[model samples]
Target: MAGIVACVLLSLVTMVHSQVQTAFLEYMQSRMGSVEERIAQWHDHSSRYSSELRDFKNQVLKMLENIEKEREAMRNEVESTNVRVDRLEREVDYLETQNPAPPCVEIDEKLTELQIKKKKNEKYEKLTDCSDTVSQVNAMKILKRFGSSAGLWTKDPIGNSERIYVFDGAANDTFFVFPRMKEFTLSTSTRKAARIKLPFPWIGTGHIVYGGYLYYVRQTEEFQVIKFNLANKTVDDSAVLPIEDQVPVYGLSKHNYIDIVADEEGLWVIYATRENEKNICLAKLDSKNLGIEQMWDTPCPIENAESAFVVCGTLYVVYNTKLPSRSRIQCIFDVSGTISSENVPVVYFPKRYGSHSSMKYNPKDRQIYAWDDGYQIIYKLSMKPKDELH
Candidate 1:
């Protein structure tokens, strides 16, 4: 019985040892698998972080390169600006050193005569744009004989049909009219040309309608102002300008310019006297009395001023200056005193080689037509914006 107890106890001890060994072996195998999994996770995380760091470094390097390029471009722009500044300064200094003078008037008489003849021939045609044939046809025949009637001023709009007033300087005593046809039979007046007598020969100055008379200048050193009665179509000697006013000023070298115009107020005369130097004077005279009512002296020493017809009570003087004697500057003055505190002058252009009579303004179209004596061509001026004046 004791021997049987010993064998059973030994078997129990062996079974316990075998169970402990199996449990230890299972625990060691599980720990080894966990350690290997941890190493693999650490390696994967390290590779991801290294790749991200390399991408960030490349982005930073590209940004730095772009900044350097921008800095270099700015430096080049600054250098170019400095060079332009230096070049402009040098050019200004050179211009100041030269200090050029204005050009003198080159009055070539032969050229002037040729230009006058050409203009006369070109404008002489009787462009009678009338609806009636009797008057228009008869008038054109008379105008053609005159060669250049000096009427039908194109300064007016192109399509206007008005009976044009004609004047003859060679026969300074006569004027003619081209009437528009209203009936098949011509008006007795239309068939026969109108005739009038002048105190002198040459109606060179622009004429104006005033006090039922036509006032114009004669081409002579003395007594230039003459008048023709429009109602009678005859010259009235008693209606001539006053003898006292006609007398030239003392020390006056030449008759610079004489312009007459009649408005709602009365007759107005503007003439420049060459009393040592040119001085412009305005005289508002009574059409009948031939007496001056108001006079004002222009501020500018006009070299030569041309008189354009008055419009809307404003008198405009187109003048050119001969400054010290190289560049020709043309000036237009509004003598009406409506635009400014004083008479305002507007500069037009340089080298105006044209005639005063040749310059025509059609206010309806806002176009300026000029007959260029130098180029022998007619030019139409383009409209300019006010801001472009400077």
Candidate 2:
């Protein structure tokens, strides 16, 4: 009886196992079908996309062909226009030759008035008895090897100290101060200059040294002026004037937003504004607090100005070309209304390595110390009396 029960249980277990196997086979087939269906859908989408890609490519090629045709038509039209213009110019020349009429030019009354005024006020147009003109520029000496091509080197225009300050680029924190001008021009070692670090970083090579104080534009959006006391290496004072940084003061010098300069008239700041990008704005800066005492909207356009400096409250803006060549003082603005810009004549700097990065007019020396390329140079001015120009 026990043996018969064991055979029945074994038969029941085998039947259960066969049923499980059959169910698993059906599940696997369903899974395979699902996978096959997804594969087919993917193939169909890929084919459609490929066809669309081919159509897009064909359309692009057609558009390109149309563009080429239009370009060719425009080129031909331009050539025809040029020919017509040449013919018109030749006809005009012939007509002018036959008629021999005086050249008709709309003269500017304002300019004529200015010329008249300049002639009348020629004697009064002076800083002292007469403002000196840059008669000659001498690249007397080149400084030690600097990594950059643009830099600044200036001596104190107020004190009797023979110390010289140097800057390598527009943006820097450390400026080297040499004991004397001779040591600065001749020495190659960095040890010769006492590296003075600033609490606030300086922007642009447009820094000036005067009365034992180093005045520089603080590296900020406002381009605030900072007076760094050389005697103590401490921040003496700072002032922010109404100046825009949207456009640099000079087009060529994109980094020099504000230029601080000192002359016989004391401290001054030169800058450009977004509202008036074409013209330069001048402000008299109080050296004690770097405060704005007076402001002037100059007629001197800032478009081609590369550098500028103040002398006897008169701003001498130096202009340069896109291609580096001889820089010239093309514009002048006198705050006192005593000097006439037209009468002064255009002053040019002698051909050098390149454009000026920094130009500081030393009132004590009555010379302009400029950084041309990487070389330091000085411009000697010939102060001609107004009576002599007559």
Candidate 3:
């Protein structure tokens, strides 16, 4: 009976062990299948994520390329605009000349005197370019040319004596006056021509005049106020400036420009200084304290007022006005205002006109002479008596 009972226990234990082993195998299989399914799903998700990331990167690269192209295009446009502005400013220079231009000023009686040497003797003739097509009536004619050879030609305040002074062009650049003599023969052994030296290389532009042993500049890029003493023949390097209590455009730039004139009372220098785009200063040197006492600003940029002069204390500004169509009008400023259709008269030309030069006012003759490139041409003007000028 004891042996049978032991056998039953052993069998029961074995059966129990088998059942536990089978259950453990089924659990292991189920866990392995779930792991495989999860692994497949993770691989598919990773592939899809990688493809999407690549597409996003490509879109970002395209956007960056577009931004770079836009930046380059803007840079090119800005560069082009700057180039155009520079060109327009260059055309505003005063020295620029047109091919076939208009007249500078109106020519009238009293001012058309041309000192010509017809024969060996001096003869006064009406100054007119026979080539001129404009209508001109014969005013009184006079011959003032002396048999003396031509010398330096400059405009002066005094209208009498010689409307134009002539000196040898070969005169050295030392300020010396021509002795009031026509012919001189200092023996054939020692031949000295009648010549004077200017202080400096007579700067090639503007009206240059000689009087009171001083050389004057009607217009130039140099300082507006300069003097060449005939006694010493040296540039008054002292470089007297008309503006005392004023600032300059830069440390190097000066205020003097265009024209200058001198009389017994003092010297007058007309200069241009730009303040803004629209405002331009036309300062008049008073010469009292070596500074500008009176200054006037104009809206229009004066083309060239150096050819202008004061008559009876009234200032006349000569300038060229460019119309909308680019046609130019050479006009003069009067006492009325800077520009007025009634007061501002257009310079009269026949077939055409050309460049300009220095000008002078003859208070005695009541006329204005422009030292033009062609020759001296006269214009009639209505002005008050000189004595009335304060």
Which stretches of candidate 3 lie above 4 Å from their native place? 1-152, 155-193, 207-211, 217-224, 231-237, 240-256, 262-266, 276-280, 286-290, 304-306, 319-353, 380-390
Expressed as tens digits, the lDDT of each residue in 1-390 for candidate 3 is 999999999999999999999999999999999999999999999999999999999999999999999999999999999998888777755335544466697765344223111121122122221111111212322123322121234435533333234432222243323332222212221133334545444432323454433444422344434555444656553344533332222111122244555422234454444433232234444433335434544343354332455543344444432221111223322222322333333443222133334445544454544433333345545433322322
Model 1, residue 290: displacement in angstroms?
Answer: 2.8
Clashes of 2: 0
Q: How much is 177 displaced in model 3, in angstroms? A: 5.6
Between candidates 2 and 3, the TM-score winner: 2
TM-score (C-alpha, index-matched) for candidate 1: 0.39
Give the number of the best model, judged by lDDT: 2
Model 1 deviation from the true structure expressed as Cα RMSD, one decimal place? 27.3
- Candidate 1 clashing pairs, residues 3+ apart or interchain: 102-325, 102-326, 103-325, 103-326, 103-327, 132-181, 173-196, 173-197
lDDT of 1 by residue, 294-374 (tens): 555554344454333333233445554333121222322223443321323343433433333323333443333332321
Off by over 4 Å in 2: 1-147, 386-390
Ranked by TM-score, the better of candidates 1 and 2 is 2
Best TM-score among the predictions, by candidate number: 2
> lDDT by residue for model 2 over 167-247, one digit each (tens)?
888777888988997787678777788998899888888888888898888865566888889999888888776554447
Question: Cα-based RMSD of the predictions, in order?
Answer: 27.3, 22.4, 24.9
**Model 1 bad stretches (over 4 Å):** 1-161, 168-171, 180-200, 218-221, 237-256, 263-266, 320-353, 358-390
Please give the lDDT score at residue 280 for candidate 2. Answer: 89
